[model samples]
Target: MGIFGFFILAAAGYFLYRNYFTTNTYETKDERYNAARAQRQKELDGLLDKINRRGMSSLSERERQRLDELSGK
Candidate 1:
């Protein structure tokens, strides 16, 4: 095989390996925002559930602080 052919194949293999092995690469800002939003939504759901079942007034001081933080107060 010609040197040029070997070089082309090696370049393709390197690219394939890099693509397969690289950690997550965010493609757009929206992707990053969505991930953070999902996490926050999950946290809010759990917090709301606790408040509902236990009563907001019954929550401990720490739980109240968490709720306030989630509400951005």
Candidate 2:
């Protein structure tokens, strides 16, 4: 029973650590930049969808500039 209790407590602690204490640690600048670029691409895709459904006018100035910057236009 003591061994079982220790295993249960260890499992719980492991889960808590994973859920609350883990941090993203990139190994290199390129890795971080690629992650950021992918996130921006996701955002740009969402904006493009919005533009398709509505129009360019639907985008705020900040969003439009972001789109242009991402597209290198």
Alpha-carbon TM-score of each model against the true structure: 0.58, 0.58
lDDT of 2 by residue, 1-73 (tens): 6999999999999998987789555369888889898998999899999999999999999998989998999
- Candidate 1 backbone collisions, by pair: none
lDDT (C-alpha, whole model) for all candidates: 0.85, 0.91
C-alpha displacement of 6 in model 2, angstroms? 21
Best by the lDDT measure: 2
| Candidate 2 residue-wise lDDT at 19 | 78
lDDT of 1: 0.85
> lDDT tens string, model 1, 1-73?
8999999999999998888777567468888889888998898889899878988887789878877888899
Give me the overall lDDT of model 2: 0.91
After superposition of all CA atoms, the RMSD between model 2 and the true structure is 5.6
What is model 1's C-alpha RMSD?
Answer: 5.2
